[model samples]
Target: MKKPTPYTVSARLYDLISFEWPVYGAGRSTAISLLDLAPGSHVLDMGCGTGLNFPLLQRQIGPRGSITGVDASAQMLAQARQRADSAGWSNVTLIEADATAVNPAALTPHQRFDAAIATYALSLMPTWQTALLTMISATRPGGQIAVVDMRTPTGAAAVWTPLARLACRLGRSDIEAHPWSDMPQRLARVRSASVRGGHIQIRVGSVGRDGDSVPERDAALDPPRQR
Candidate 1:
């Protein structure tokens, strides 16, 4: 058997050690709020990690909607499955696969998702660019995608740099990876918000018909088309 890493060592204790309430939770909440998903809408929670975002996402998606959460860690998925089972959320689906390599078509066999979000997960993937492109490809045209991840603090908040670096090191995340910066080029109506003294960045954008953005007339008239 493989030795456990930070994520796999204690999946059950992740929520407590993750600093959700004071630090990372704010980014997840803010990012999900910006998704603007409607009830019954299908959403994807990339790197769902112990289902930490499930309850918040469920509030927006409701019982009728579904969530497909993908992660590479089996132990983490086990914990996530437990959370879903305890909550009696039949709508939640957990997949054990690498987000960087998993084929979206296999995950969403019938239809693409209405919205997708990745919270504090991308910075850990070396191929985060491919992971993000897969997310965009998995959503329907005009659907929303949100990326929430961290970076070193700015301005006066730079005082927190050492602490931030230490946290990232402990979590096995790249503190310098600005994965959210690529959103504008791939999607339209891109918008962003920063919090925690600029350490966390939230970016939400609508998938464009052409990936460069459809003309207003085309956007109004055309039906969903695969990218």
Candidate 2:
């Protein structure tokens, strides 16, 4: 099994040290806003480390809606569970599993989710595209699918390129993996945004009905792929 070392070993310190408010938070906030989620909408959060997106998501989803958060790190899920409990959010569900291997039908007996979001998570997986495909399949047709990831800074932000690369390296992410690049081909009504010196990239789009089937390839690799 591939260990999520940063999350597993330092899950508790993640919220404090992850640069949520000053930097990475911008990407999640922007992605959630673009989701255009409706009240009572069921949502899936793939690779939902420490449930950082829960607060913003709950604001829009409300008590009537539900959130299913999945992560590979058990330590991370523990933190997420505590966050939900402390917030008194009974609608939240946290699962320990690889995003690529989770079975949508087994997640909930209810219909497919109204939307799904993955933030700062996909680039860490070698099979990031496969994880994205799973998110699309778990969501209802026409449901929104949003992805937020990172890359080296560009343009006027070029000065921060080294810092950006260093961050990705520490987090065990593929800084060169432009996972969001798949949005145009796999989705509709595609929209995008960038922040943090253009190091963060966000992609949001609607999943078509035909994309709701799991790919034929194996979801769980014998030796989990790495960057």
Candidate 3:
């Protein structure tokens, strides 16, 4: 298999896979449920991927809210645009930029966000720490960051850490070498000078076929097309 630009690999299949697969749907539910905002919450769908979570975010945040979908792929953004146009989602903004390299001031100059969410996108980044930290940086006081990604299984197979090793060997795009397996713990230790908001990170790891939903298995996915 040849390496394709993130957009090329995702454009058609991105929307298809997300909708067709029950995992993405369930995971999105989990992510959107965590937002817990009153109204007018600025939600960031990091790794927005065809804007699968856009509607859910909008519904949670309601009419007073707004969302921005950031993806490194312009092609993916194009597909997302189709969804936005189809649904007439004017509040959702699509910005094409590398997540780790995004300018925080450019994202929200005057105000910070109520929540930041990434579904199945963290593992795709080469520098996930930067990506993760960037999300935290963009958050406002009392805001929350919800990241859902694959976890490195502990002592599975005839291997100890074989999954992570295999992910590394899988090259890059299609497979995630290092996942946010320990985000909850890592976030707890990460000190920020902010006052009102206390950090709460919950790390979950499971060994099941629900890889697509859970974010760890991360196998090559092919979701069906929407009518």
Error of 2 at 23 (Å): 0.6
Q: In model 2, which runs have C-alpha deviations exceeding 4 angstroms?
A: 1-5, 212-227
In model 1, what lDDT does residue 83 have?
A: 96
Candidate 1 has its poorest 10 consecutive residues by lDDT at 218-227
TM-score between model 1 and native: 0.91
Compose the digit string of candidate 1's lDDT tens values, residues 7-123.
888687888888788788888877887787899999988988899889998998899999999988889999999999999999999988888999989778999999989998899
Better of 2 and 3 by TM-score: 2
TM-score of each: 0.91, 0.90, 0.68
Tens-digit per-residue lDDT, 84-155, candidate 2:
999999999888888777777777576889999999999988888888988888888889999999988888
lDDT of each: 0.85, 0.84, 0.58
lDDT of 1 at 73: 88
The TM-score that candidate 3 achieves is 0.68
Question: What C-alpha root-mean-square deviation, in Å, does candidate 3 show against the real structure?
Answer: 11.3
Candidate 3 weakest lDDT stretch, 10 residues: 191-200
- Per-residue lDDT tens digits of candidate 3, residues 1-227? 54455557648775554432532355455545544556788887888878888877777777778888888777888888898889877788888888888986677777767777777677678777777766766766446666655433332222434543454344243234334444533333211110001111122222122211222232222222211
